[model samples]
Every structure is written in structure tokens, then in C-alpha cells.
Target: MDRNLGMDFVRATEAAALSSGRWVGKGDRHAVDQAACEAMRRTLGDIDMKGVVVIGEGERDEAPMLYIGEELGTGNGYAVQIAVDPVEGTNLVATGQPGAISVVAAAIEGEGKLLRAPDIYMDKLVVGPAAKGAVDITLPPRMNLKVIAKSLGKEVQDLTVGMLDRPRHEQLIREIRQAGARIRLVSDGDLSLALEALDPQGEIDVLMGIGGAPEGVLSAAAALCMGGEIQARLVFRNEQERERAKQLLGTEDVDRVLTMEDLAWGNVVFAATGITGGNLLGGVRYTGWGAITHSVVMRSRSGTIRWLETHHHFHHDPRY
Candidate 1:
């Protein structure tokens, strides 16, 4: 469906400003997330839209804002399904790191399904189309890396991979080191990390790590639109979380690898407005006198991704 793509930037910027800061460590992630939610809610109020939360902060009653099944938009246009991460890297923002962003994607409602992601960790691997079927998450990380290396006609050491900069990634990191492969460790945010994996020419060959299941789902949605292969499996740490997941998914099978089509099915449109400077999208630019927002509006139906950097000027209200 054709909707107002340009105005989506207004909402994106609002989400970004609410939670801009160094919010790393055990600091209140809720505040940053809340900022994005509030902005999203308010921004939705201004548009004639009907959308469902496919991927959100949490389920109903669990997360006060942006819960699954929560209705958004002004309720006047075609219904759409929205998956949002107001601040993809709360820790990065809190710690003043690069690549922090307020990310969101939307698809036609009913055609899209929100993933009842398990609270437990999910192992994720992504590669471009050329390397499709070359890597498998079922194998050990080293073996998978080797396959990817062979597919790209490069040594494992020449392949640059993206990883999270956390102690939990110690073994994964060590294995890569032992293999003589280089690793690009990110302090926070995996949304861009996942995107990086899709662009081999961009220097990031693959993305292998354990991250939030919801994020894994969102990345799958984006990759679905971008033509990449991603495999994910739930890795629960406790029975309670597993049971909760099973109950939500309405199935006992937690070990499933979701493809791009599985993440975002049918027709969808993705709108992203940059709140901070980074690759894939540019940061919000201020001209001192006013502000100009840069954005990329995409439609899956047409496979057209347009780069738009628009300027919005604000001056004092004119009162007669």
C-alpha cells in the first residue's frame, strides 16, 4: 500500500531525540525505550494510519509501551504491521558510541506476523546472496566461517566479521582468533551489524553472534527485504523462559531457522529516518537555523529503495 513515507521521518526523529545519550551498562534502559515509544505513539497520532506491533518492546502488560497487538497510527488508512526498536543500541547511546539508532520497519497488516520471541538468547548468522547456502549455523562457528571463506574465494583470515563486544562472546572471539580471521567487535547495536553482513563489499563478510530473539526477528525482516540468508535458533537458559516462549509461540519447537520470507511475508514497506550519523543512513542534520532530516524509504512490492535527504525549517510562530 502507498502511504505517506516522507512524514515517517518526523516520528523517527522524535524517537531519536527522546533517548540520545550514553545509556550503557545497568543504567535504566526503560527510559531510553520509553522515549522511543512515546515519540512513536505521538507521531502515529498525527498520521492517518492503522498498524499493529509485529515486533515490539514486549508483550501486553509486560512492556508499558509498544507492546505486541497494540494498535498504532491514526486509524484512518490501510492497516500495517510495525516492528520498531526506538533505540537499537541503548548501551551504545548511553556510552556515546557510534551506530546507535532508532530503527523501525512496517509491513501490510495481516500479511505480517509478530514473532513471539523467546527471552532466551538466539544464535544468528547472516551472509549475502553470493554466499547463500555456504554457511550453516548447525555447524560449529569455525566450520561455518570456513565455508563462508571458501565461498568468497578468500582465506578465513582475509574475511572481516562483525561481533558483539561482550565477554559472553569470548569463545566465539577466541575461535576466530585461532582461525586467524579478523573480527570487528561492536560495543552496542546489532541491527546495523546484521545489515553489514549483507554487504560483502562494505567490508563486513558475516555476522555471527547471540542476541535478543526480537532483534533477530527484526533483522530477518530487513534481510527478507534485502535478499540475504539468515538462520536463527533459540537458546534458552532456563525452563521458565522456554515455557513462556513455547506458550507464546503455541508450539514446543523452539529450534527453527527463520528465512527472510519467514520474517516479513507478503507486501511491505520499510521507512527509516536517521537520528544519528552512521552507515546505511545519515544522521539528522541541523542548519543552526533549522533542521534537515535524511531518510531512506523502501517498498518491497517494487524493490525500490529511495535515498531522500530532506530539509525542514522551523522559525518562530507568526502571530498576527
Candidate 2:
């Protein structure tokens, strides 16, 4: 994969963030998501690559654009597989909360291994490099917390776990509390929280519980670049979802654990731009003549992370 392509990926995220940032706190999640999806699709077409959407917003019937199997980019460069979330936290953006982001991950086709995650719920466990070999998705929540705490050379009480605040997580949350570990319950955007655990300066020590399987793949790309770890398994709530999973994965074994390599492997690029600030990156700041965007771009091949702060002059460029 070309190193310069990483910057182009950032540009796509920045465009999506700039377009969706305006709708923050507007209480219209659909509008915000649509704005981001449109911006991302348009910007991605300008990049010089033959891209296939391995994991995306949804199937062609569910989403208007950026759907799975959709071809992106101009037909002029390297062939790649893409995973994207134009708006990671639509509710957060709608309610004027934090942790909304525009994310993209890419791997060179035929060279890298990319998972086509089914559009279903997935139970996930994530830890940073320090605790990579300690946590396991198959273990009980309390046991995994203990292992991670020990790996970090801290007591269970000193570790903090981040999880989505949903009804399905009640049992998981109780187990974490029983283990004497602190918890941060977020309204949405588990992807950002998962990435936050990779940063030593961040407060989140681990991310647990269920989230979108597509987001799990996106998080795996970032984890691969940061030397973090992710373990996930698909969950089917009913027969309809189970049938859908069988069709997508071409198998009946939904109990299998998906590791980082199973999600995203080989040389990969991950990029994200913040729409609302929280732990990982700052939100977009608007000025009189232009707006500033903050983003992170990383490559798994080199284990290199780049923080980009770009100033977009809307007046100078009609594209904005």
C-alpha cells in the first residue's frame, strides 16, 4: 500500500465531519447522518483507487449510499477494501452530546484480509497493548476485568471500563461493578471509546459489551495500528437475525470468536475525524472564514500514527 494514501483517507473523514458538524444539537439524526453519508461518498470518489465496500452503512436495500459491495473511488489506482462509518454516533450528534465521529478504514485488496461483518449485534471486548494477551471475549466479565487489571499492574478498583448504556448491558455492567472496577457508561460511540483505551494518556482502560459488528471491524483496524487487541462474536436476537447472519457469513456457526486478524489484517489504513469532542480527538471548531478539523490517521504496516489538524477555508474552496 502507498503511504501517501493515508492522507487521502483523512481528507475523506474531514469532509464528512465538516458536513455533519453543522447539524450537531439540531435533534435531527437522520439529517445529520444523510449529510455525512453524502459528503463521504462524494469525497471518496475523488481519491485515486479502485475501492470495494467490505463493511459499510448497510446492505443496498437498507442504505441509500455507501452500502456493502458498493464500489468507491476513481478506477485508476490500487484495488482496496473499505470499511466506513460516516457518522458513528448519530444520537450523540442529534442530542448535542459528545463522541460523534467520521471514520474510514482501508486495506489493499488481495493482499490484506478484511472481514465482511454481518449487520448484526456483536459482543466485544477490547484492551490496549498492555493487556492485549490478558482479556478474552469468551470469559466472564468479572474474570476478564481481573485479568486486565492484573496485566496493567493495578488493582481491579483502579481500572476503568467503558461500555454503551443500553438495557442489554445490565448484566455486564453489574459484573464489572461486582469486580470493583470503575465504569464509564456512554450513550453511543463505542468506536471512539475503544480507541481511547489504546492511548496511555486516556482514562478508559478497556471497552466491553455489544455494539455494531461493522463498527467492530473499524475498531479492529485502529487496534491493529496501535498494537491493541479486540475479540468479538456475533449475537443473534431472533431467528430472523440468525437467518440473515447465515446468509452473510455463509455459515451457521455464529459462536466463533473473531480476533484482530479475523477482522482486519495485513497492511491497513484507518482514519477518523471528530464531529464532537470527547476523549480521543477534539471536535471541529468553526471560525469566521473557515473551520478547523482534527483527525487521526494510522497505518498497521508501519505502526505509525499521525494527528492532523487541518484548516479548511470554505470561501476559498467552493467544495465546502
Candidate 3:
């Protein structure tokens, strides 16, 4: 893929964020998600790539646009695989909460190993560069936390693990607390938390427990760029989901642990724009005539991370 494609990915995310940011605090999640998805599709249409939506909103019947297997971009550039979450935390944006983001990840057509992640739950463990080889998903939460703490030159009691605050994670949360690690329970958007753990200066020490498999792959792309680590295993909730996984992946053995390279390999690019305020990036700020968007774009080949604060003149920008 062309190096310039990284910035083009950022533009798509920025358009999604800017479009959905308008619906913040509207208490309508479906509307906000639809707005973001539409904006992302529109922006992606202008880019120069023959892209396939490997991971996206859902299957063709579930979503109106940006669905799995959907083709995007101008078809004049290199062929690539795209993974996108137009509004990662729709509930957050709807309730006027924070940590909502528009994220996209891409890999050159035949060069990268893009995981065709099924729309199901996945167990994930993410850590920063310092603890890259120290933590393991197969280990218990307490044991993993101990190893991570040792790597970071801290005690287990000082480590903080971020995860979703859901009923399914009740036992996982208990185990972490028993292991003497502090917990940051978020209502949604574990991908942002995973990325935060990959930042050395960030507050999160690790991200664990179950999340969307597609989000896991997207997070893995960013983690690979940062020299971080993510270990994931698909968790088939039932027989139907398992059968769907087999049909999608062409296998019944769903117990394989996917490393960062397995999720997103080769020269990968990741881009994310904040729609609401959070730890990694600030939310969109609306001025009288324009809005400012905060986004981060990273590439694995060059290990380049760019933080952009763009000023969008709403009157001049027809996309918004």
C-alpha cells in the first residue's frame, strides 16, 4: 500500500467522528451509529484503494452500509483489506459520555494477514511494550497481573486492569481484585482501553476479558504499530455462533490463540478519531463556525505515530 494511505484512513475516521459528534447526548444510539457509518462510507469512497471490508458493522443483511464483504474506495489504487468501527462506543456518544471513537485499520491486499473476525465475543489480553512478553492469556488474571507488574517495576497491588463492566465479567473482575490489582470498569469501548494500555504514559496497565472480535483485530493493528502485544481467542457463546464461525473461518477448532501478527500482519495502518473525551484522545470541540478533531494515525512498517488536531470549517467542508 502507498504510505499516503495512512493519512487517507485518518480522513475517513475524522469524517465519521465529526459527523457523529453532532448527535452527542441525543440519547439515540442507532441514529448516531448510522450517521457515523454513512460519513465513513462517504469518505472512504473518495480514497484511492480497491478495498474490501473484511471487518465492519455486520453482515450484508444486518447493516445498510459498510457491511462485511462490502467494497470501498476508488478502485484505482492498491487492493487492501479494511476493518472499521465508525462509532466504537455508540452508547457513550448517545448518553453524552466519553471514550467514543471512530476507528479504521487496513492492510495491503495480499501482504497482510487480516483476520476475518466473526461478529462474536472474544477473550483478549493486551499489554504495553514494557510488558509485551511478560503477560499471557492462558494464565490466570492474578498470575498475568503479577508478571506484568514485575515487568513494569511495580507490585501487583499497584497494577490496574481495564475491562468491561458487564455481568459476564463478574468472575473475571473478582479474580483481578483477588490478585491485588486495581480495576477500571468501563461501560463500553474496550478497544480504546486496550490502546491506552499500549501507551507507556497511560494509566491502564492491562486490558483483559471479553470484547468484540472485530474490535480485537482492530486493536491488534494499533498494538502491532506500537510494539505492544495482544493475545486473543474467539469465544463461541453457543452452537449457532460456533457454526457461524466455522462457516466464516472454514474450521471448527476455534480455540486457537491469535497473536498480534495473526490478527494484522505485514505493513498495517491504524487510524482513530475521538468523538467524545477520553484517556487517549480528546473529544471533538465545536467552535462557532468550525470544529476541531483529535486523531492518531499509526503505521507498522515505519513505526510512525501521528497525532493530528484538525480544524474543520463546517461551511467549507461539504462532507460535514
Candidate 4:
């Protein structure tokens, strides 16, 4: 992949964020997602790449669906696998909550790198570089927190874990609290939570619990680029999903733990532009010029993470 491809990818995210930012706090969830996906798909079609979207994990009932095998880009440049959550937190955007984002991740297509996971639940444990390889997902939550705390040279009480506010995390939350670490539970957008967990100066020290499998793959790409670690395993809701997983993943056992490489490998490019104010980046702020957007772009091969603040001029660009 070209080194400058990350910049092109960020443009798509910015477009999504800019379009969707208008719908924030509008109480229209579907419209929020539809606007973002349309803008993103349009922007991606102009990029110089032959890209296939590997994962479209947004909840179909809540937001507009982007087909899993949809072909993107101009189809004339790098062959890549694309994964997107054009609006990671539709409800947040609708309700005027925080942490809504537009995310895009890509890797070389047909390279057997980025995992095309079945749309199911995935249990994940993610941490930053300091605690990389020091925590294990299979271990007890308290035990893992202890190890992570030790690695970061902090007490357990000083560490903060991020998770989705779901019933399935009840036991996990108990264990984390028992271990003396604090918790920050959000309504949605696990990808943003995972990214903040990887940030050295970010408030989230770890991210633990179950989230959508497609989001897990998206998070895995950011992990590869940001020197973070994620350990995950597929969680089947029923026997039918298990059979479908067998068909989709072939003989690869879903019961096995998936390292970051197994989820998303190669020189993956990950980009996210924030739509609402949150932990990872600031929300899109409109101005007389057009809008000001904040985005982060990263690449695994170069280990370069760029935080870009773009001022879109409506008169000059007219894409808005």
C-alpha cells in the first residue's frame, strides 16, 4: 500500500463526520447514519483504490446498512479490504450524547490479512503499549487488571476501564470494581472506546467486554497501527450462527482466541473522524467557512499516527 493512502482514507472519514454532524441531537437516528454512509461511500468512490468493504457491522434495524461485499473506490489503484462504521454511535448522535464517530480501516485485499468475521458477538480485551503482552483475556478480570496496573506503574484504583453499558458485562464490571479500577461505560461506539484505551494520555486504560464482531475487526486494525493489543474470541448467540460461522470462516475454530494479527494484519490504515465531542477526538464544529473536523489517521507499517484538524471551506470545496 502507498504511504499516502492513509490521508485519502481520512478524507472519507471526514466527509462522513461532516455530513452526519448536521444531524446530531436531531432525534433522528436513521437519518444520522444514512447521511454519514452516503457521504462516506461517495468520497470513497473517488479514492484511488480497488477496495472491497469487508465488514459493515452497524445494526441494520437502527441504521442504514452498507453491504458486506460492497466494492468501493475507483477500482484502479491498490487492492484493499475496507471496513467501516460510518456512524459508530447513531443513538449517541440522535440523543446528543458523546462519542459518535466515523471510522474506516483498510488493508491489502486478498492477502488473507484482515479477518472477514461473521456478524456476531465478540468478547475482547484491549490495552495500550505499556501493558501489551502483560494481560491475558482468558484470565480473571481482577488478575488481568493487576497485571495491567503493574505494567503501567499504577495502582489498580488508578486505572480506568472502558466498556459498553450492557447487561452481559455485569459480572465483568463487578470483577473490575473488585480489583479497585474505575470504569467508564458508554452507550455505544466500542471502536472509539478501544481507541481511547490505546491512547497513552487517554483516560481509558483498558477496554473489556463483548461488542459486535465487525467492530472488533475495526478496533483490531487500530490496535495494529497504534501499538495496542487486543485478544478476542467469537461468541455465538445460537447454533445457526455457529453453522454460518463455519461456512464463512471455513475450518478456523471460532472457539480459539484471536490475536490482533488474526483479526486485522498487514500494513493496515485506520482513520476516524469524530462527529460528537468525546474522549478520542473533538466533535465537528461548524463555522462560517464550513466546518472544522478533527481526525486521527494511523498506519501499521510506519507506526505513524497523525491527528489532523481540517477546516473545510464550503465555497472552495462545495462538497459539503
Candidate 5:
């Protein structure tokens, strides 16, 4: 892991904190994402790497921020590619919900591949390496639950599934309820759900849902570094989305079995800064003195995971 390279991602997360939830999202999600995107783009420029947006917000016509394939940095030395989720949970921040974070990951030259994903739907299922091949989205939800339950030496009712709280998942919710398995519904943020799947000893046993295609790929990257498994199938219900996907993916088989290596490819670093409250990590805390922040930084090179909780105390004067 490049120690200095990690700082670029650190700056990106810090800039994401300056968004709508902090200043942009409450009433201006677009502006908030834009600000965060610009902040991320500029911060990346400060580094000594030539980078491009492999996974990011939306398309150029659909939205602003960091669109897919959008090149970043100042075209300098040391070619590097990035997959970033500037604001992983924009709606959560805008509506004052939970599980909002600023996340970014990168890899060295020739070790990364651009994730050309259009704004389409993708069915995702993920779990740690231990639970690999235990959960299959193609099968019925109940059958999948039972498979995971047996693998973990737990009852079906004891398994917890994390999913996006969207109307499209009504059938999945019903199935989970009927199957008697526990369900953890989240408003926004697929990366966290993916990470939950990567943590076997954690709360979530499986992550299954329909969300952004780029996010699915990014989650696959994290899962790859953590020795996890994920399966994704792109869903294009309209002509525009299909055309956009073809243009991006250059293939018709979006329903491909993609491993973790396929997602991130080579060595990477994953780091995130919380923006709101949640179960996995606490939200940013503030007080009369200054503010405090919590972060989880991981480097695939050394398999080191660091949980940093910092407090900053400020005085009226520049120096005491």
C-alpha cells in the first residue's frame, strides 16, 4: 500500500463531509453531490497520480458530480485509477436518515480496470470468503437463506439480511418475513451492506438487493480485498438504459459471475468517513470545543485494518 497514496482518498472523504448533510444535501442533493464531486476531483489533483473515474455518480447527461469514465487529476505522473463513492448515501443525508459516508478506493497502474457501467439496475448478493457460494440470488430468497443458515450453523430465523429500502424490494421483504429470517433494511448506501456481507462475525449475514451497477462493482472490490464473494446482474428495463449499458459495458452479458478480483483487480485501499449515524460506525460528533470523526482505513497490500476515532479541540486564538 502506498502510504502517501492513501492521503488522496483521505482528502476525498473529508471533502464529502462538506456536502449537503453538512451544507448541501438537506435541500440540495444535486448541489451537494456536485460540491463533493468537485472537492474529490480537486483533492485527487493534489496527488502525484494520473487518475480517472472508474466508478462514480451518474452519466454526463443524467447528473453532474463524477460521472463514469470522467478523467480526474492533472494528468501527471504515476498512472492510477479510482473507484469512488463521494456520497454513498445522498438520500440518507438529505432526509436526515442514516448510514451516510464518503468512500473512495484506488489501485496501481495496469492492475485496475475501468468499470464502465451505465445508470442501470443490478441485482447483488455478497458474503465473506467463508460464506462464498453459499448464497445464490438466482434461487428463491428462502432457499438462499437456508443455505447460508446451514453454512453458518444457525437457524433460518437467526440470519439477518441487509437490503435497500426501496419499493421494488417489497417482494423480497415479504419473502424474508415469511421465511422467518431477520431483515435489516437500509435507506441508502450499498457499500456498507456489501461490507456487512464481508464481515462474517458482524450483524449482516447476506447482502441482497437491486441498486446502482457501479456500486455493485465497487462493493465487489472491497469484497475481493476482504476475501468475499458477490454476484451481480444488470437490469435494463428501458431502451435508453440498455443502450447506455451496452455503450459502457461493451457486452450484453451483464449478468456475469464476477469475483472480488474482477471488481477491484489488484492491490487497493478502502477508507470511509461517516456522515450520519448507523450501526457499523458512529456519526461525526461535535461539541463546544471542536469536532470529532471516526474512520475505517484498510490496505489490501498488508491486510491491515485501522479504526481511527479522533477528537479535535479548537481555541479562539490561532495558537494557545
Candidate 6:
């Protein structure tokens, strides 16, 4: 894939963020998601690549666009596998809460590049580059926090773990609190929190919990780009998901610890733009001149991470 493809993906995410930004406080998650997906899909038509949707919004039956198996992008260029989350935190955006983002991650199309997982929950444990080899998701959260704290030269009490605030994580939260580590809970967007774990000198030290398997793949791509680490295992909620995993993995054994590479490997590019203000990237802000959007673009092949603040003049930018 061309090294410049990362910037093109950023433009797509930026378009999604801008389109969805207008619907904030509309109290309509479907509207938020649809606006983002349509904007991203339209913007992608201008990119110079032929992409197959290995992971995306949902299955063809569930979403109108950017769904699984949907072909993406345009122009005479490279073939790639794309996984996108146009509105990562749909509830946040619809409710006018903070920390919503539009994300896109792609790998060179091949068997070993991106895992083709169903829309199931995935248990994830992510850490920064410094503690990549230190923590293990199979171990207890307390123990992993200890190893992470040691790797960072800090005490367990000084470390902060971030995760989604869900009923399933009640015990996980209790255990982390028992270990004397701080916890920051969010309503949505664990993918952003996973990247926050890699933010240099960022507030969050680690991200742990179950989230969308596809989102895990996207986060893993960014983690690989920035030298961070994310490990995941699919968590089947029912027999249907279990059967789906079997069909995808070619076996009945659905439980296996997946490394970062197993999630998203080989020359990968990741791009995200915040729709609402958050830690990783600032939300879209309207100015008298135009609108300013904050975005992060990364490519694993070149080991590059670029944070961009783009100014879009609605008059000139037809997409807006």
C-alpha cells in the first residue's frame, strides 16, 4: 500500500466526524451512525485504493453502508482490508456527551493481515510500548496492573486503568480497585481509551475489558503503528455467535488469545477524528472562518504518527 494512504483515510474520518457533528444532541443514535457512515463512504470513493470490508459497521443485513463485505474506495491503486467505525460512540454523539470519534484502519489485503471476526464481544487488554511484554490478559487484572506498574516505574496506586462502564465489568472494576489502582470509566468508545493507553505521558496507563471485536482490530492497528500492544479473545454471548466464530475460524474452538498482530498485521494504516471533545483528539470546533477538526493518522510500515488539525471551509469543502 502507498505510504500516503494514511492521509486519505484521515480525510474520510474527518468527513465522517464533520457530518456527524451536526447531529449532536439530536438524541438519535441511528441518525448519528447513518450520517457518519454515508459521509465516510462518500469520501472513500475518492481514495486511490480498492478495499474489501473485512470488518466494519455491521453485516449487510444490519447496516445500509460501510457494512461487512462491502467494497470500499476508488482509483487504480492497492488492494486492502478495511475495518471502520464511523461513529465509535453513537450514544455519546446523540446525547451530546464527549469522547466520540470516527475511526478507519486498513491492512494490505491478505490472509494474515486482518482477522475476519463476527460482530461479537472481545475481551481486550492493552498497554503502552513500555509495558507491551509485561502484562497478560489471561492473568488477573490486579496482577497485570502490578506488572504494568513495575514496567512504568510506578506503584500500582499511581496507575490508572480505563474501560467501558458496563454491568459485565463490575467484578473487573472491583478487582482493579482492590489492587489499589485508579479506574476511569466511560460510557462508550473503548477504542479511543485503548489508544489513550499509548498516549505519551497520558492520563490512562492501561485499557482492559470487553468491546466490539471489530473495534479491537482497529485499535490493534493503531497500537501496532505506535508500538503499543493489544491482546484480545472473542467472547461469545450466545450459541449464534459461537457458531459464527466457528465458521469464521474454521473450527469449533472459538476461544483463543489473539495477539496484536493476529488482530491487524502487516503494513497497516489507521486514522481517526474526534467528533466531540476528548483526550485523544479534540472535537470539531466551528470558527468564524470555518470548522477545525483534530485527527490522528498512523502507518505501521513507516512507524509514523501524525496529529493533524484541519480547517474546513464549508463553502469550499463540498463534502461538508
lDDT of 5 by residue, 1-320 (tens): 47767755765676555443454336667765776677676677677778777777665334466766677666776677778887787777767777887788777776555355666688888877677877776889899888888888889999899998899999999998999999998878877888877876668988888988778877766776677788777887888787777676677765575555555666777777777766665666667786566667777777766666756464531011
lDDT of 3: 0.89
* Candidate 1 residue pairs that clash: 21-93, 22-93, 22-94, 22-95, 23-94
Off by over 4 Å in 3: 60-65, 318-320
Q: Please, what are the lDDT tens digits per residue for candidate 4 over residues 96-156?
A: 8899999999998654368889889999999999999998899999999999999999999
Q: Lowest-lDDT window of 10 residues in candidate 4?
A: 57-66
Every candidate's lDDT: 0.67, 0.87, 0.89, 0.88, 0.72, 0.87
TM-scores for all candidates? Answer: 0.85, 0.96, 0.96, 0.96, 0.88, 0.96
What tens-digit string does per-residue lDDT give for candidate 2 at 1-320?
77778888888899889988999999987788888888989988888899989998766324344888889999889999999999899888888898999999999987786788888888888899999888878888889888888888999999999989999999988888988999999989999989998877779999999998998999899999899999999888899888888887788786789898888899899999999987778888899988998999999998899988888998775233
Write the residue-wise lDDT of candidate 3 on 233-311 in tens digits. Answer: 9998799888998898888677888888778889899999999999889999999988999999998889988889889
Model 1 agreement with the true structure over 153-250: per-residue lDDT tens digits: 98988988887887889998988888888999887777778877875555788888888777887777656656667887787878877888788778
- Candidate 2 lDDT (Cα, 0 to 1): 0.87
Give the worst 10-residue stretch by lDDT in candidate 3: 57-66
Candidate 5, poorest ten consecutive residues by summed lDDT: 311-320
Q: By summed lDDT, which 10 consecutive residues of candidate 2 come out lowest?
A: 57-66
TM-score for candidate 3: 0.96
Instruction: State candidate 4's TM-score.
Output: 0.96
**What's the CA RMSD for each of the models?**
4.0, 1.7, 1.5, 1.6, 3.3, 1.7
RMSD of 6: 1.7
Error of 5 at 296 (Å): 1.7
Q: Which wins on TM-score, candidate 1 or candidate 5?
A: 5
Candidate 6's C-alpha runs over 4 A off are 60-65, 110-112, 318-320
Winner on TM-score (1 vs 4):
4
